[model samples]
Target chain A: MSERYLFRGNHAIAEGAMRAGCRFFAGYPITPQNEIPEYFSARMPDYGGVFLQTESEIAAINMLFGASAAGVRAMTTSSSPGISLMQEGISYSCGADLPMVIANVVRGGPGLGNIAPAQSDYFQATRGGGHGDYRTPVLAPNSVQEMFEFPKLAFELAERYRTPVIILADGLLGQMIEPLEYTFDPVDPKTLPKKDYILDGCKGRERRVIRSYDLRPGYLEKLNFERIKKYQKIEAEEVRYETDHLDDAEFVIIAYGTCSRVAKAAVRLARNNGVKMGLLRPITLWPFPKKMIEELTGKTRLFIVVEMSMGQMIEDVELVVKGKAPVRLIPHPGGGIPTAREIWERFQQFREEL
Target chain B: MRKVYHRPEGLTDTLMRYCPGCGHGIIHRIIAELLVELNIRERTVGIAPVGCSVFADEYFNCDMIQPAHGRGPAVATGLKRANPDLIVFSYQGDGDLAAIGTAEIVHAAARNENFTVIFVNNAIYGMTGGQLAPTTLPNMVSTTTPRGRNTKLAGNPIRVCELLNSLDGPVYINRTSVHTPQWVLKTKKAIKRGFEIQMAKKGFALIEVLSMCPTNWRMSPIESSRWIEEVMSKYYELKLFRDLTKEEK
Candidate 1:
């Protein structure tokens, strides 16, 4: 009764960030993710926050690094190419363990990959972008409600892991409106833990420093190993996925982000027709739910992977399946949201093959 | 007080990860000294770049935040906007500044962001090993430029300060070099001035330091420095494109 609000996914992200103590925002306008910066820019200052339209996605991400290093919550949003521009900054944030949120309303890519609803950035976001061995925690939100709720989770994840967290949505999820709830206590930026690494102003205090460079070859190697250890722990602890109708199904449809919504709709369509297909939706991409996928391999021989990309996450599903099951990709890039009929047809083709 | 030229106390006690003769070290040291002298060492925040300067935060004694490559300007913009009292700067390289990040640099400067940019321009890429850069001069040979940089084929290297000067944003823009002791001193002065202007809230300040890549250039460090003076300067002439101290009407 107490936790309801009417909001769009993008607005929810802005609200969540504000609730989570994010006081700065810098972003270049892009499809799907534009509303996020638009909301913050228009309303942030009214709430004692600062909003800026950065020169580029590259600028927005670097701005996030600046604000986050100052020990405040900050974020930026963009689609495909914009996200590519942000890879370098994302790597730096990962290297430095800076806490910030990056939202990628992915569209198709390679060049200015179309801006329709596509999920082509899976490889870029989950893989170690930029250079070096570093990974940020990537979350795939399936609904407008999840969209609003995930920013706070992202901030917490970023602070807990001392790294960046990405909210990987697509055009559909970003554009859609939904009912959501605000669950957290009112945030006071003044009471947040003091960041020993923040660069305040040089008026007082001893010099403070932050960096990912370890010149000693051995030490660099050790530091990299330690970072990997942290990633491993995160993979183990942060892997989140949802299983619906998993108990009574011969075919389990695997998807994430927006495609999973299509998959959810397809599950209902297939069930009404007596085909009976369950769904497995992964929320976390980097610490991918490999264990869950591995376990699901025994329950189903045919698994359908729908994505906006050509076949990146499907590759992850295959890796865990280890040839134990059949995995296929229903790719729609450039923000193309597939219809329930298309998914149903794909399921028919898979069933025919079986 | 002692000069303490080795490094700054706020700077990380890390050695150079840059390849031999990389100009990033020179630029980093100059900025480090400026930060130290300005006594903003404690309150300063730096956004490190991609390419060779990704480790910039490591060498600086101030609070460093390594941003996604090319995203330094954006991050620094956020930091500066969030806390107008904080001193924020972005140390970016040619590849990071003029290539994929061109829009970012232009827009940040265009917006008259209250920060400084230490842009290190080496005609060839350094960190990922020699490749053609945005600042690569005509007839320059690099990994991607097998038969020298052809302006007709690969496009002319952008003169950042000149290009930015054409805009209405930046309050200070100086293009210098670190190829010689005199130039290094000049570069340091330019850096200090940029920081000084930022402290005074003049506007966006940029110090484009003509740098060198010895290993990538297939030349000795000394020769590379000389090349910067003899060849690169001919293409990217040293000039102060904007002077914030002059009080624009």
Candidate 2:
């Protein structure tokens, strides 16, 4: 049975993780995401789950490494600076092939940027932020309802690919209140595929070793090739995006996360003003919906990339567009969301240049 | 004639990878021997630190994980918390635990995380070509400390067991060495006791061994063994710092 309830985005994410059978959660207190661990602390103990407030972000992520290796669903949450502290562990999880979920309630930052909503972490989340030639599947949630839904999907993708998955939510989505419908079924650990490589003891089985270090010649290369193969599989099968008024539109806007919601409103306004504008919201940022951009380049007159950063994802959009269509970027520096009126204004300015 | 001596069931047939006369092989043997004797060989999960002992998973005939540098305890905490019935331990070297990993070990102890930690303090970084470690004694020369280490400049050696003894989280804390046959037996007893405390679900337990690094110490095996007894043991000491089970009794 499904139920609907009022929830803040952070609370919806917490509930969504619990529904996805996260039995262990460890985190440190950070703004915009403190409510995540705070909610788990009150709720996990009642269900015999472990909720730990670690000393630092480093400790929390390492705890996730341990819990996941023990063959249980484990997770951690942090904002920007905290996520920076977690880079080494994140890289380690990738190297060791541990399945875990991380939620970054992104605040503005190059370093201690601000405790406001921002999509500045787009590059850090999409690209491997740590020292590795690897990529984690990044899910960007544009709505409070998506905040409730992406956790389950993140865990599934993580386990399916044997890699870490990130739910990239900005502060606006995390702080805003909305009605969320529970659509996912609570998963049972027993029903999940047996993790034969976990470090849960060697009883009645061959001793298992989970390590990333390979000093031998050509050994690490082989391991990296395997990782690349898995990533290719993910990129092939897991590209997700939402397209609105794309067909027969003269102007198109590419955005994700909070900016997507704003772009949708701007598209509506542009249509009312006799401008043929469409919006494409990428839900899976890493396995980016590049195919859609390729298909739309010939149909649209101009592609406008909207983001709350100094133009990160625009590079990716342009790479796919391949100069078939002229591309322009409307940048919003961190710490606040651009209003629909502001986005509509940008559309008008770009149309004038056209 | 009966076969009087045989390799323990907890060790694989893989040849030892430690440098000649390194203390890691002996320590590995002791852990395997204890695991077999305690009958927890199968239900034991060991986390290998990213140091000289990073390949420890290859030697142990049980489930093992090689965590990133200084992340052994954090990994062990997660493993033990998730699987309460399993016996979990982490094998770490001095640089791996006492230096970059100081925050992790200290907080793990403060939390009273129920697990065992086998800390091998050799006082110098061996795997990365003999750099000065946090446990490196004053005036000790390494690749990094070209001249003798200056306490005023490089900070004094960290007595890990003493530092951790200040924390109230751990149930058993002891420092032992394996310089001689007698000391080997005592170190083994300490390792076994750590596992016993974890089995009792007391709290965190640690057995810090003052191991040897002959190649990096620029000495012969026997000379390094003497150095540990004469120099390392003088400062680190060979004594139990805390024992909650003894207090209860």
Candidate 3:
């Protein structure tokens, strides 16, 4: 049995990145995620990795761009406001087809809104947060174990797709501590397959160039079309979700991240009270489990979308459901977490009305 | 018969899109020649900034990355720190290095990042048309400053070498021009020295090249070169502000 150790979500993320062979990390300090950079600063040197406390979040993301272009697994962590500052670099990484990982420990936001846990950035993560036409694959981790294990998966998806990957978490998850075990042995970067497109040097080969712009007319359009096909491929292959009693579930609660954990408890409460409620937790928020939701729509009478914000993920749920069933939202905007008892009571009320 | 002149292997065959008599071509040629002369062509990784030299990734015959506007220094720091064996340089324009990316450049210098920076100060935003630049000379006429730059309104031109020379992290900081043939040779020498310092793992080194922008300045090629020597050089003095090698010697 793997030995279990108590770890905070933020520190686990840093440790998981190091174990995943991330040799470069640059990030600015922000609330709920300060421990990430602090942990990396103290531990990375021992692992022969580089850690940089950058001037701003913009510099951190741009640094990731450079490190990723040089064929190194790199990561950066920031909060809501800081993540907003990093959009430009993230868009550039997408345009240039460079691979990198970014973790956004969400806090209440609209502008320095507060350091309380919130899921207001769901729309920004699923849709391309930055300008231009692109989508960054997003992974929503709810548990401390998922926080520790997601960085390795995020890096794999980033390199496999040659695009930026976002690990979307909230302050509640980042601050929570739990016992966790390593899911796999630490990776040795030297043993990894060599990437052909890295810009380490042009020795014994033709020189390579990595750029986002195509000045020639119609060239950028062509590139965009090719990238869209890659997105489609990912949608087909990378959709991931967890189902709880979904087979016989007449009512479903759809949620993710911290809210999903609450919804899971609410589902258990409803089941104990002789209600046929189920929970569907989405892991990959970008290649969202659209097929599973559509399949569930046939058997489900109603869907309750519980979120820490004002109904952001509900839009995706509604789109997938296609108005076949009614969807209701239990929104607690601005750092409010819905209690399991409250959710169960609301479901009972809605059922009584039905 | 011996050939006296040939194209340097450091540059690609892609034709530069710069306007005629533009200083970018001249500066590009100098960097290419130095890359070959130093024999670090294969191991060098150049960063192209978003300005007139945005296409530098195509021109520089080495592994290159074109990052976002004004982010060259941060990118270079990452590349150099991640792999110490790789030779990295960031080629930037005035708007990129001084105006928008000031923090990146200053912090990189403060860290004494072991890399080379080629800052081209043409006194105008060449790529975005004739707008004002951070290094624009006082009372100089630009599109934004049509009636000439007012020192009180627009602020004074930044003396980049002098500003950076005050920092202890930088091992070498020099300002050179590429207008006259003598100054062009001197600019090449200063840039070469900057790369040499990086090769020796000394510290951060910057070579500020006061270049010509004939199209943006709306002047003839000869007049543009003459303007750089007579007018621009007065505000930005052509001299070495800091040289650790010379200090030690």
How close to the true structure is residue B95 of candidate 1, measured as C-alpha lDDT? 89
Candidate 1 lDDT over B162-201, as tens digits, reads: 9999998898999999888899999999999999989998
Off by over 4 Å in 1: A3-5, A109-113, A129-131, A201-208, A212-215, A265-277, A308-312, A325-353, B1-37, B46-60, B65-72, B90-102, B118-160, B174-192, B207-241
- What's candidate 2's DockQ score? 0.88
| lDDT values, one for every candidate | 0.82, 0.90, 0.93
Per-residue alpha-carbon lDDT of candidate 3 for residues B10-61, written as tens digits (9 for 90 to 100): 9999988999878998899999999999999999999999999999999999
Give me the displacement of residue A275 in model 1, in angstroms. 5.9
Q: In angstroms, how far off is A171's CA in candidate 3?
A: 0.4
TM, every model:
0.80, 0.98, 0.99
* Candidate 1 vs 2: which has more lDDT: 2
In the order shown, what is each candidate's alpha-carbon RMSD? 4.7, 1.2, 1.0
| Per-residue lDDT of model 2, residues A1-354, tens digit only | 467789999988988888888899999999988889999998887657899998889988999998998888899999999999999999989998988999999998889999998888888989988998899999999888998888889988998988999999989899999988878677766688777788778887899988877889999999999999999999999999998888878899999999999999999999999889999999999999989899998888999999988899999998999888899998887787887898888778887898
Candidate 3 structure quality by residue, lDDT tens digits, A1-354: 989999999999999999999999999999988999999999999889899999999999999998888888999999999999999999999999999999999999889998999999988889989999999999999999999999999999999999999999999999999999999889888989999999888999999999999989999999999999999999999988998888889999999999899999999998998989999999999999999999999989989999999989999999999999989889988888899999998887877776
